[model samples]
Target: GAGVSQSPSNKVTEKGKDVELRCDPISGHTALYWYRQRLGQGLEFLIYFQGNSAPDKSGLPSDRFSAERTGESVSTLTIQRTQQEDSAVYLCASSPHGSLTDTQYFGPGTRLTVL
Candidate 1:
């Protein structure tokens, strides 16, 4: 079976530009997540989607950051008006279910650079 995957493994953009990062989770997985890791920092949760339930977006940093998922499949994270502080590796993960104890399989992050 396939694991989580992200596209455009590296992205370079200027400040004030908009970027969209894509992710594909394991088939049939009921839960998907988006995270961001700043240089030398731990991962920061950005969003979570589970089945048909409303997504948990509390971890999104600001209005500039948003994400969407279609029926537990592909997900996309959009960063508007990119900023230097937004430079980081964007990670995606998936679990069999949206449970606190479920193991999450991670995708190689899409490294974003904001100049």
Candidate 2:
């Protein structure tokens, strides 16, 4: 009955470097999400994955940001050519199902710092 979890709780990287953040959602959950929170800003939706359906990636900021998930398990968010503007808290969440009204359980987030 573990909650969602993210790895490397803190990441420090230089500009132009690439970083991969990992997430493990609750067992049996069929929906997973990735979000970003910038300084003094609200959470920004990055991507969403549900069951075997195609992922919703409309929220991704640019081509430099990408994510992947296999089945209903672990997910990874890769940021290529990191930028200073990319410094923020990357959050992961999961719900029982991919529904708009479902409650999402959040992880502690991986703080990414770009220098």
Candidate 3:
């Protein structure tokens, strides 16, 4: 993908169902990240994968929220046993992270609405 791309931009589901969101980052980029934004709150970093290093999973709200990136390109986020509190926009970002304060490019995000 030229820029970060996310699929199924909007999702509505009954609570308790599982969901998976996909992300395709820009080519040649080396870092990928997932974030969750609830209502009016600022973006919360969920997981970050840089190169082959151990993924930084410091921000996932719970074990139910998990993400994976294959190599330096595509990634996916899965939310299990979804709850109403999980309703929000799931965003993915990637950047050329060799330098400090790299500019992260964002995707439009998948809006998950759990009823």
Candidate 4:
């Protein structure tokens, strides 16, 4: 796909397990962000990164949740010891640059289910 894309639109995992989801942003976009939406809830920020700098992890629910960005390219979000409460849609978005929120484009999202 030419736009941002995500793998395994749905995932099911047992509690205490770890899961890794992938994202591919638009070509040449340098800014990437991760967010999650609990069932019937608003989007909660998780992490955002500009190029190779350490991402802003303030929005991460816990140390169990972490992400990394490589250059201005791909990213991965890993959830360790996943819990039922962690079940949600993991969305990846990208913009042209990191100076500001410049119309972030989102993928279909990966639905992580912690049973």
In order, the Cα lDDT scores of the candidates are 0.95, 0.97, 0.91, 0.90
Compose the digit string of candidate 1's lDDT tens values, residues 15-64. 99999999999988899999999999999999999999999999999999
Residues 15-39, model 3: lDDT tens digits: 8899999999888889988999999
Which of candidates 2 and 4 reaches a greater TM-score? 2
Candidate 4: what lDDT?
0.90
Q: What is the TM-score of each candidate against the true structure?
A: 0.97, 0.97, 0.94, 0.94
Kindly indicate the candidate among 2 and 3 with the higher lDDT.
2
Per lDDT, the best of the predicted structures is 2
In candidate 2, which residue pairs get closer than 3 Å at backbone N, Cα or C atoms, i.e. clash?
A: none
Q: How many backbone clashes does candidate 2 have?
A: 0
Greater-lDDT candidate between 3 and 4: 3
Worst 10 residues of 3 by lDDT: 93-102
Greater TM-score among 2 and 3 belongs to: 2
Superposed by TM-score, candidate 2 places the C-alpha of residue 50 at a distance from the truth, in angstroms, of 0.6
Q: How many Å off is the CA of 82 in candidate 2?
A: 0.3
lDDT tens digits, residues 7-69, model 2? 989999999999999999999999999999999999999999999999999999999999999
